[model samples]
Target chain A: MALNIVVCVKNTPSSLSVELDPSGQPKTAGVLYAINPFDEYAVEEAVRIKEKNAGSTVTALALGPDADQTVLREAVSRGCDAGVLVTGTEVTGGDTLATSRVLAAAIRKLAAAQPVHLVLFGKSTNDSGAGSVGGQVAAWLDWPGVLSVKKIESIDEQAALLWRMMEDGIDKVKVGLPAAVCTVKEINEPRIPSLKGKMAAKKAVFTKWTASDLGLKPEDAGAPGSGARVARYTAPAKRGTGLRIAGGSAAQNAAQLVDTLIERKLI
Target chain B: MNPQGILVVALNQRGQASPATWELLGAGRALADAAKQPLFAVLPGGTAEQARELVERGADRVLWTAHPSLKEFNDEMHTQAVCAAAQQLSPARILLPGSVAGRSLACRLAVKLQAGLATDVSEFSPSGMVKRGAFGGNLTAEVEFKSPIQVMTVQAMAFPPAARQAGRAGEAAELAFAPAAARTEVISFSAEEAGEIDLGGAERIVSGGRGVGGPDGFKAVRDLAHALGAAVGASRAAVDSGWIPYRHQVGLTGRTVRPKLYVACGISGQIQHLAGMSNAANIVAINTDPECPMMQQATISVAADIFEFIPLVVAEIKKRKGVPVAA
Candidate 1:
């Protein structure tokens, strides 16, 4: 079967090295953006599935500000057939529910044209690291969702066998088609984009979707319709000042460390 | 039942009431007490034995249902069960563990209910505010639910497990929901080696990173872990390098853990890595880099090579515990 897959990627800071202001909000100054590391695995997995099953198509779906296009381009460079950027204030700055609703709406719209057999997501976004949008989207779409997916054992029009990775073990799952899945690092090694692919991505144009385009109310995307709202941001508690041990030898340091632990009853 | 009662999803692992469930009960107990509302535990997939355990721990009442479909965790079945329980009980707030399954299920339940949800919540203020990690715990986002029902996945280990009352009495009822066929089937389960400490329940953890060099370097970490009765954790770097298995990886990309003590050996902390274990009661960073983020964040920073220092510390801990040591 020629499956149609939608891989959602998040555009996050290239590195988590950004500084938090005193109020604990991340400072945007000097921040560089790139495709989230985990999403690369999802895009790679989708691309791989597309390659094996000829005539299949992979659509890179993103929801954020205009900066999201960079992530989509990267996805295209990695073999995604097309891209869709869901942006604008009415569809941005949402918590998991809002985000999931918007993504599910976008998927619903895409499925209207061509039935989407599967939706793929990374383990988590580096920024929020909530690790739930994939399943939440599945919920909104009324589709079965599997998280911590390590492998796609097999997929056909009717069903897909997936390996769900848990802390202690792996559970093999057989899910009905048109399911949403979140991929983990153990799935596959993501490939680097070739020059030709990059050139193609440079010239590529992404289809944009918003609340209205997806036939959704403005309240369905952001703070207005969000179940959870950030009341405020606070700096994390400070750790007690460190006690540095750089004394003479390994034995001396070890002795001192043990003594401290004993005195504090930490051991 | 009051409209504002706190409903806890008391989950059973291998048909037993584990610490994770008890922890939810403990937090739920406090929340219910503060609100002066009854505490309810919803056992979506467990027997009466586990339901009794929930009452002994903290629940004032237990809503238990043990359908054959729930014997194994299928997302649709669990969600349907939970949604059914929520619809009937109508809890003001619902809490679940912030574990992998817990988070996944919470996400879906919130969508199904169209409720506000906070994941990895560390604290719930009496005035009805939720504090959770955002930006990988670099910042704390205080969340408020706009919806009528609030749902959250409380951070595991953030609260002490509720103490069991030997003969506490509580009400128990079976939840009735129209059963539907599950959309997923569990074919098989292949678990890691038995006897390895499950990181979610581990009280202490000793972790390694790229600085550990290779597979052999993990032995030092494991030795120290053995001495301290701690679980072994690895950063994504070490796991990706094949020095340790993915199960041991503790970071944003892996498991989020909140142990009593987290010891980092040869691991220069990445923000994503710190996101997983930053909530530990104490952190000790043993690395040569005095300026690394891990060292800066550690309660105790040791400036020394892990290879040379780990053995001495291991021997000292062993000596203190009256265990045999070469030195």
Candidate 2:
């Protein structure tokens, strides 16, 4: 059977060079956006699995504003067969739960057209890094989900063997097919878009879906539906001025450090 | 409905309450006291001993549920158990540890309860505001729950564990709840051969980065840590290069450590790495590059080859302690 994979991607500020508005939200107006760094790993992993499996199709999906189309386009450029952009007022500014709900609804809609055998996501987005959406989506779909997956040992029609990174060590999990898998950076190196692939991505037709298109109401998704809101933003406290200890050589420096530690009784 | 209490979801490992559980109680106590609400603790598969320990640590009441299937963490079952407790208790807020298991379970519970969820929260206020690092610690944001019920996961080491008072006591009760059938099963759990040190409580840490060269390079790091009685740590680069195990990794994606003294050897200090150790009381950096971020932020910056510097430091420590160096 041909596998149908949906890779969820997010568009975030290109870098930490962001200006917070008076209300503490990142000012998005005219700011550069790129595919979330982690999501690129997910996209790469999906493309690899597609290359390995015959007749497999990878559909890239994103839930955000029109600027998020750039993320989907990047996915297509990296070898996704199709792209879907789910946007509108009801899908933006939502917390992870609300975002997962909208994405789950879109995945359901996609499954209606074609049975989805697998869903993929980055371990977490760079901006938020909550790393909860994939599991939330799996719960919404009633499917098993695995996080921080670094290796895919084997895959067949029924189940997939995966190696997940854990605090103590690696967990080798056997997740049944039609499950959600969140990829870590160690999984694979993302490829740059080829010239031909870029051209194809530019011409690719995107299926845009609104909240209503996915059978979701404004209250069921986005900021209105979000359970959490940012009340304020503040810069992290600055560390004390670092002291640069100098010495003539390594031994001298080491002695200075040891003497200081002894003086302060820090050791 | 009147806010009933602040509920803490305790985590367990090999039948004992994990350290994160105690830390959550510390934060929970403050939040509960400020809200003028009771503080309740629930363990999905915890034992009576663990429940009693929580009471000693400041829990007003403890609720525990246990089953053979619950012994190992199954997200589906854990979420169901916690949600069941939340539904019955009607807590205004729920606090969980932001560990791997906690984050996943917290997300599922938020969906099940349709509550506001925050992850990696480091600070909490009685007025329902939480502070968390965003953009890899470059910025911090204060968030609030729009819904009646709120859920959040506290970062490890962000709060000290509650003091265990000898005479402190509270009520303990068994939570009667049934868990759903699990969709996934753990075939086996294999731990890495290297004994993992608990970095959360380590007073000092010696961490190496990619500039440490390779696995062999960590020998010096280990020797220095052994001399200083500090835990050995690694940056993401070193860990990703397979030079060290992930358990020893110190960074945003790894363990967050707040030791009194942090000695970084050969680490260039990416922002992600800083996010984990920036809070350390005193940071000492040894690197060849004078202008690396770590060197700039370190309380004491040593410009030298770590391979050369670590040995001298270790020898100096040994000599000062009256231990004869090996010939």
Candidate 3:
């Protein structure tokens, strides 16, 4: 059977430069948002699978603010056959549970047109880094879900043999079709968008959906639908200015460091 | 189902609780106390020894199922087993250690229970809400659960292991679960090479970064690690440059390590990297730049060339340990 796949993407402020306002919320001013780094690997893996399986289609699905359209265009330029952006405050302001639920609903709506063989997500988002949505989406869809997938060793229409990153090492697992998987960084090296691909992306018009379009009520979609709320935001524990050991010969400084470590019983 | 009390769950490692599970127990005990609820522990694939250990580790009640199918992990069947446990107990809150399995299972379980959830939680605010890294670990969000049931997977090394009350006997009941056949089958598991330390639980880690010019630059870092019997870690820059495997990468996206001591060599200590090792008991930064973030946050900062400093540290530690120096 020809497989139909959906890869989810998120665009977030660069991890390297997030500054919080006094209210403990991310200062959105002047922050550059890019396709989450991990999702680049997801899109790459999806496109590769699409290439390997003839007649397969890869749809890039993103649930975020309209600004996330750029990531979808980026995905299309990379290799995705189509792009759909699900926007509105319902998902953008929600927690992982509500967010996963909305995405699962979108998948169901997508399935109404064509059977979705697989759903893909970056292992986690850069902003939250919870790594929960992928597995939760599987739960909502009642499909086999694999988390932290490192490799797809082999895949047929019926099932895919994949490797999951585990505590001690890796587990080789075989998951049936119609499953959801969260891809890790080790999956594949993403390709740069070709000039032609970029031009196509520029001309591509994306399909947009709202929570209401996905059949979710206002209360069941956004912060109102979320089970968890951020009661407050706090700064990370302040680490004291570290002590410096310098102005000595290499051996002497090394010896002093060793002595200090020994004194602290750190080694 | 009426939900009350705190439920602690951890994936078994060869029929025993993983080391981080005890830490979960500690956090659970504290949370349960603050919430004024009973503490419960569920071990779906646990043996009697692990059940006893959990009891000694302060689980007010232990639920275990030694289901054979669960002996080997089949995510579907194992998740079913935990769901069965939760269904039976209907605890108000569930806590798990942030192992790969725990995080995965926790999410699926949350969906099954229709629970509010959080992942990688590091602390609890004064009001009993969870505190977790957000905006790439630069800000902390104190999450409050609105759902009747809450599920969370906590970061490793964030809390101390529960103190074992030796010789204490507690009640453990077999959790009867008729598991559904899993759609996901396990073919095999390849263990990380023996003698190569896992950074997650390592007490000491020697990490390299951008200044480790190439793959060869890691040699000095490795030498220091070997002398100290420590795991080797790397910053994202080094890992991205293909100088080291991703397994050794430590940062927000990589493994979060809370070692007793962390030695950073040639690392610039980006905020992302600091997110992983900032909690270490002691941080020793060896870098050429005096004003770098890693140096500033380090417990001991040495502004020196890693190439020179690493060799000297290795020799000194080896001498202190009474080992012969290499020719």
lDDT of 2 by residue, A1-267 (tens): 578899999988877656788777787788778889888888998888899999999999999888688888899999999999999987888988899999999999999998898899998877777788998898788788887788888876688888877655577778887888888777877999998779889999899999999999889898888899777777787775476777677789989989988887878
DockQ of 2: 0.67
TM-scores for every candidate against the unseen true structure: 0.96, 0.94, 0.97
Clashing pairs in 2: none
* Docking category of candidate 3: medium
* Positional deviation of residue B279's Cα in model 2 after best superposition, in angstroms: 2.8
Model 3 chain B scores worst on lDDT over the 10 consecutive residues at: B10-19
TM-score of chain A of each: 0.92, 0.95, 0.95
For B1-327, candidate 1 gives per-residue lDDT tens digits of 445799998766555666788889999999999989989989977988778878888898888998877777777888888888887778989899876778778888888888888888888897799888877777788888888888899988989899999789898888885678878888888877876788887988999999989999999999989888899999999999999988898988788889888899988988889888989888989999989999998988899999999999999988888889884
Q: What is the lDDT of residue A101 in candidate 3?
A: 91
RMSD of 3: 1.7
Off by over 4 Å in 3: none
Ranking by lDDT: 1, 3, 2
Q: What is the lDDT of residue B127 in candidate 2?
A: 67
Decide which is better by lDDT, 1 or 3: 1
**lDDT (Cα, tens digit) per residue for candidate 2, span B1-327:** 665789999978646678888889999998888878889988889878778888999899888887677786667778888887787788988998877678778878888788888988988775678988777777887888888888898887789889888668798889887766776666667776564456765788999999899999999999999999988999999988999866687876666777889999999989889978887889999999989989988888888998888899999999999999996
